[model samples]
Target: MKLLEPPVSDYSTVFWDATREERLLLPYSGDRPFWYPRAVAPAHLDGDGEVDWRPAAGTGEVYAVTVVHRPGPGRAAEDGPYAVALVELAEGVRMLTNVVGCPPEDVVVGMPVRVCWHELSDGRKLPMFTPA
Candidate 1:
């Protein structure tokens, strides 16, 4: 299926690049932490723009989730009653993604999940969560 989204720019480019590369990217400014990409470190209020990008452990647990029986626009092939889960990575960042590899009814809160790559029609890979 073709999922469409706008191209990322600015500090968030690193995130899109990492997703295409099938890796998890985390942003760090010195000792401070950040997510979703920003021009400066939110903790120290530093505009140094000295962010560092690094790979993160893709292992995580399903913090919470819900099954979408009715697919939304452009998500028709996602299968009825598919799970959308809030995955809490080992780094403590929680990202919402689709949980695959099993029936949606079988998924439960706090279940173990791992990052997996789903290839798009354009050859870019996106991250998804699956049973660990």
Candidate 2:
């Protein structure tokens, strides 16, 4: 089954473009990295929040995980038992992504993973994770 396309806005356009090339980019302010691409970094709210788009190492460890028994909207029931994980990237940012290439039961906290891509119907690539 096809997954829903992620919303791409002007602020996140660079991120989406990097994903298309099989690379991961994160928004940064100074040395701190953040997710959910925005014009301003969460830490530099007071001063001028200059966002820098930078490449990520694309390696991370699973911080949390869950097995989905029931598929949500736009998902197929036959694809049940998928592993959804919160991965803490090497840059110290956590992103919600699917953990594939292995059984859901095998996904556990602190498990190492690497970036992978899932192509959407609209030609956009969605980043996912698999065992590193």
Candidate 3:
């Protein structure tokens, strides 16, 4: 399905850029393990946060999940439900994404998954997970 793409910004742009390369970038500096691209962490008291990029193994466990019977804009029109999951990466960060290569009903909490890429028409490769 088509998801809402955010306007380009200095911080988030770097994230989208990395995803295009089939990589996932999460801000990790001083308690910022799982922040989404926008606000990476609590603001540093006296200085900008030391943000750096680390290559994630892209392997994770399913932390939580839901079966989306109702599709949204740009969603694939299929029989019905699809799997959307909150995955906790090996790096100890959690991400919200879909579980593909398997049925939504087959996905279970604590299931293992590996990163996969979905190439968009705009040339962006978004990260999704499939059963490992």
Candidate 4:
């Protein structure tokens, strides 16, 4: 999914673009990989600018979650009380996102999930998770 507040760095721009294409990018440090955008490679990696943008499998297991009983400002009322989860992707990168397509009670730790994108009115897509 696309971020509501788009990142302002060149490296992150690649990430936003990939999300628009319905893909996820995982940052790699040689054979070890991670997520979230960073300017430098991991301390153990030996090369400069060695990080490559690779497509993620977009599948994960729910590591944690919470149900938002109260709606936040600017949030859609229809989406209130939604379950937001921390998903640990198959690549070992964890991302925080809302989990849709199931009741709040149905969301649980270790549940299998798939990445899904939602397009906002401004034409930006945001990543979300749903039960697999």
Best by TM-score: 2
lDDT of each: 0.77, 0.86, 0.78, 0.77
- Tell me the RMSD of model 3 versus the true structure: 2.8
Q: Write the per-residue lDDT of candidate 2 for residues 86-115, one digit (tens) a residue.
A: 999998989998999999999999999999
Give candidate 2 regions above 4 Å deviation: 43-47
State residue 115's C-alpha deviation in candidate 2, in Å.
0.3
Task: Name the candidate, 1 or 3, with the larger lDDT value.
Answer: 3
- Candidate 1 residues lying further than 4 Å off, grouped into runs, are 41-50
**Candidate 4, overall lDDT?**
0.77
Q: Better model by TM-score, 1 or 4?
A: 4
Which residue window of length 10 is worst by lDDT in model 3?
Answer: 38-47
Count clashing residue pairs per candidate: 0, 0, 3, 5
1 or 2, greater by lDDT: 2
Candidate 2 C-alpha error for residue 107, in Å: 0.5
Would you list the clashing residue pairs of candidate 1? Answer: none
